[model samples]
Target: MSNMLLTVEQAAEELKVHPKTVLRYIREGRLQATRIGKAYRIDRAKLDAFAGVASGRTRPPHGVRATVIVEIPALTTEAAERMATFLGAAALGGDAETRPLHFNTAFDPTSGDLKIVLVAAPSDAARLLELIELQLGLSR
Candidate 1:
């Protein structure tokens, strides 16, 4: 057990149970959680302690991280600017599982060609895309 933060879903995956089950544990005061706004963050140490008490052995917390890169082309200047701004903000405001996001932009005003490069951890990639889509009003 170490000082690691995991979401309820991740904890549930580690415990081989549903996320709702994790929530139930939290509600029942069986699992320790830190409520962050609407979500719950579980500590790795506490999770391992709980597991040891439950199963008579401690299980190591899973810590796997992946880097992901995504590129978008044919974006308008306004859209590219918005995406860049959002990426910058998101990088600064990563949650428990999210890593820093890196963004690169190449825009040619004369040719109206805009290319955006997004680098982020896998856990945060989906969220980054959702934000991009929301900001740009794009379906992709």
Candidate 2:
């Protein structure tokens, strides 16, 4: 069952449900999936398991995993404090709808030098960087 992979829409169609519902199931750990970029690829076998079936599936094609680094240059003391606060809220804001990417941040209290690392597929790196830039008001 691992060989066959289905997108969220395809899986939702197979189960006769909305795509958001399918995403919800994934979030609640009811359905199994491997996140690809901003999307998810569900294994056919896991789908069967989810449906209480016993079919073994095969692996699907996967994209190259990559990392993106966002180097936030040293900031003024006040701006650094603000950035820290923003990061705290950003983490809290992520929930079921967030991407399956991994994130790590290194912050310097005295120097105000910050570095953010995001792990995702190669294709998603740009979008993730855009999001981070927007959050930091760099777009303006």
Question: Model 1, range 45-127, lDDT digits (tens) per residue?
Answer: 66765554333333346634445555566667786666666665555564323333555667776665656566655666667
| RMSD per model, one decimal | 13.6, 12.4
Candidate 1 TM-score versus the reference = 0.42
TM-score of each candidate structure, all chains considered together:
0.42, 0.43
Q: Candidate 2 versus the native: TM-score?
A: 0.43
lDDT per residue, candidate 2, 10-59, as tens digits?
Answer: 99998889999999878755577899999999888666556544343332
CA lDDT scores, all candidates in order:
0.67, 0.67
For all candidates, the clash counts are 0, 9
lDDT of 2 at 21: 96
